[model samples]
Target: MNQQRIDGGARRAVFAPVDNRARVDAVVRRIGDAIELGLLGDGEQLPGESELAGQLGVSTVTLREALMALRQQGLVTTRRGRGGGSFVSLPEVPGEERLKARLRGWSTEELRDLGDHWAALSGAAARLAAERTEPEDLVQLRRTAAELAQADEAAACSRLYGRFHVELAAAAQSARLTREQVALQTEVGALLCLVLGDGEYREEVSERLRFVISAVQDGAHESAREPAERCVRESTARLIALRLTL
Candidate 1:
């Protein structure tokens, strides 16, 4: 009987069969979920492949296969040296004109679906920010808001606004929620900067920032959530309209 044996104290175990590809895929999926859920973060190093494999009950080769897939997706990078490991890559924010061009190929429904997701996550973030915010966090939030207001160009405002949302998420004090909020904000801001190329639209964004700040400042968790959701939805709709016109 040719059976692979596992050596453990007093017991040797043999597994019937295992799918290496499936195992690799599972590892990839698990890591992706961790990144999405904020269990992992950009530039954060992952555990050693051998350790991860042991944790997941798989061979190192299987884990390497999964890491390769992530590398292809530009989600993770690996370095071969002392104190080096797989690290999460930061998501890039596309420029306004570039994002607009990209969206020209997407359907209205697809854009709307993106909007819906953004709204739901952002609403939750606002509520959490209001509920958990501290004085120091509020100070940072106000500073970001002020920067957004002072920005002269759409590009500048877009970046500052994105930062404002990040600060709000930090105030929320939940690592998972903050991670989701950051992801959504990055995606939404990239798209919005593209569609909202005019001063009027940016002004609207600033006004929404004001509303968010006020709600969080007053500890109005419920009020903040709805307005944040509305802001995301409204911005999405505005982008859709712009796409239609183009």
Candidate 2:
């Protein structure tokens, strides 16, 4: 037999026994969720393929297929050396301008819906962070606040503001909660940048950042939730008003 034919036949033989799309998709989603929630950080090693398959209760072939999908989505990378294994790839955080462009097509109602979701999720995060934050996490939170205070340019301030929320979510120490907060922040950040791309708005945002940090530092969980929630509501209102003017 020709070498090409032999290779094709072997490939067919290898995969001919497995066919479970649902199982593969489920595994892929579980792994993707882990990545989103920072349970698996960038460049971190993953368990061996067989081990992961066993842990997830799926066949080796199904697990391999799921991993291939993750690789396609830029979520994980695979290597072949003795020390090499699958490693998580951090998803790129979108820039403020790029995010704003993406939100240009959203209707006013859609923006309101997003704001509502953000308020509820962020309020919960503030409450949880106040309750669960360790001293080290609080220190990181303070550092983020300092960065916001020292930012001299609008673009730089926007980026730091984004990081501030990410740090607060991390302080909560719940992967699921962090993921939800990150998603909401992404949307709200985009909208805020779109509506308030001026010096005045940047100052307002900076003031709000100060209040949130002070509340958290004071260990007043309920107090912290109010500023975070108000920020979302006010930003949403600003976006809606700008859209109306346009």
Query: How close is each model in CA RMSD to the real structure?
Result: 9.8, 11.9
**C-alpha lDDT of residue 25 in model 1:** 69
Candidate 1 versus the native: TM-score?
A: 0.59
- 177 in model 2: Cα distance from truth in Å? 1.6
What would you estimate as the lDDT of candidate 1?
0.73
Q: Which ten residues in a row have the lowest lDDT in candidate 1?
A: 1-10
Write one digit per residue (lDDT tens) for candidate 1, span 74-152. 6689988898899987456344443554456456987898888877777888898888877787888778777776777
TM-score per model over all chains: 0.59, 0.55
**TM-score, structure 2 vs. true:** 0.55
Total clashes for model 2? 0
Lowest lDDT block of 10, candidate 2? 94-103
lDDT of 2 by residue, 1-246 (tens): 687887897878887966598788768767765665456888999999999899999989999999998887777899998999999986575434333433454678987887788778767778778877667777876777677667665556655776777777778777887788666664455345554467677678778877776777677788889998887688778877776655
